[model samples]
Target: MKILITGGTGLIGRRLTLLLQKKGHQVVYLSRKKENIKDVIVYKWDISAGYIEPEALENIDYIVHLAGAGIADKRWTEERKQEIIDSRIQPIVLLKKYLQEKNNSIKGFISASGISCYGTDTGEARLDEHSLFGDDFLAYCCKLWEEETRNFTPARRTASIRTGVVLSREGGALPKMMLPVKWGVGSSFGDGRQWMSWIHIDDICQLYLQCIEDENITGPFNAVAPAPIRNAAFVATAAKVLKRPFWAPAVPAFVLKLLLGEMSAVLLGGNYIINKRMAEELSFNYQYPELETALQDLLK
Candidate 1:
């Protein structure tokens, strides 16, 4: 099988590409410019200019869309918010237009979404994919991002992985999280009771692989682990894994709001997101379901 991956340089994309190649599948990347990516071919696409390298679409079996602006990378000013939405949406529109123009069809379309689709602060309510869309900025952004995936009617199967805090040493939230823990000043955000739905990096990549290969999996699937830990417990587990003390006081919500602006929701707010469809409906096996074990593997 040959696959085309957008945002292939990202932490998950890079790891997923290697896994695909190991399974005897060919992987190509869509980038802003054709660069020398080790052991893979990169094709250029300028979403702003509305041009995608024609050869990139040649004989592609599936598309794994991981391209997007980082949600927590900056303060959510009106400009940054638009950027976050457009970054995710424009790529989809471009792909759909190109595929339609060439009359090309792929077997599946896998997209990246956020667990914040159910809002940043949903308290302890156990939310599923069928739950109401979130009302916050993050939820609004994810809603728009997933809606754009509907354009790919050519792909027989379309699915969106509503991802959570992906734990890995390479990138994403874990490294930044581990820093304070390593220094023995680890603490939780806000009141420390907000739920932090998380998953191991390998599990998420495998989820993406399943979406590509399995015909039964479709629509939005929560990409979270079985156990959803509270913010304080989540921090405590990290401290234990790093062999450090977890005695620091929780960061006040107001301080985070002031420091991060609206982007504070990524840390100061959360939901009890359930991976029902992915775990029960799909029966997907998790490589690291326990938080402590997952942290130990990444931190050790």
Candidate 2:
């Protein structure tokens, strides 16, 4: 299969590309940078200017739309928020327009959606793909992103992997979570009862591979681990795995609000997201099913 991946230089995209290649699939990246990498072909695209190299789309059998501004990268000012929305929405619009113009119909369109679309949970309960849409900034952003993806209807099949906090040793939330624990100054945000629906990075990539190949697996599927842990438990597990002490008190919610503004929602609140559809229908056996085991393997 010939796959064209947007934002292929990102942590998830970079790893996903290699995994696809190992399976004997041809992978090309649409990047902002045009640097020559060994076997990987890099094509350039200017999102703001609405331009992408036409060759990138030629002979592309599958497209994994991973391109987007990091939600938690900066404070969510009005400008930053628009950037987040545009970064996700514009890419979809651009891709659809280009594919239509070329009369290209791919096998499927796989995109990266966030579990935050379920919104911050007020109570600890298992949430699924059918859960109510989150009304927060992250949720709103995800909705718009996914909505744009729907534009490819009647022409191409699509699958949106509603991903959770992807745990990775290279990058993602795991490294930041490990840092405080390593210093023995680890703590949780707020009361620490907020649910964290997480998945091992390997599992996330595997899930994407499944979405790419399986035509029946369509719509929004929660890409998360089976066990959902509390923020406090998450902190303790990281501490235990790192062989460090957890002595610090929980960070006050008010302090976090003052520090992060609207972005505090990502840390201060979380959903009890479950991979019900993915597990039962797709039968995805997670590489790291439990939090402690995932931590031990990554931290060790």
User: In model 2, which regions exceed 4 Å deviation?
Assistant: none
Residues 1-300 of candidate 2: C-alpha lDDT, one tens digit per residue: 999889888888888988998999999999887978767899999988889998889888888999888988999899999998898888888888888887778888888889988776546767888888878778888898788776675236888889898988999888988788888999999999898889988899999998887878778999999999999999998998888999899999999999999888888897888888987898888889999999888888
Candidate 1: regions farther than 4 A off: none
Note each model's CA RMSD in angstroms.
0.9, 1.2
TM-score of each: 0.98, 0.97
lDDT of 1 at 119: 92
Give Cα distance to truth, residue 143, candidate 2, Å. Answer: 1.3
Q: Return the top candidate by lDDT.
A: 1
RMSD of 1: 0.9
Judged by TM-score, which candidate is best?
1
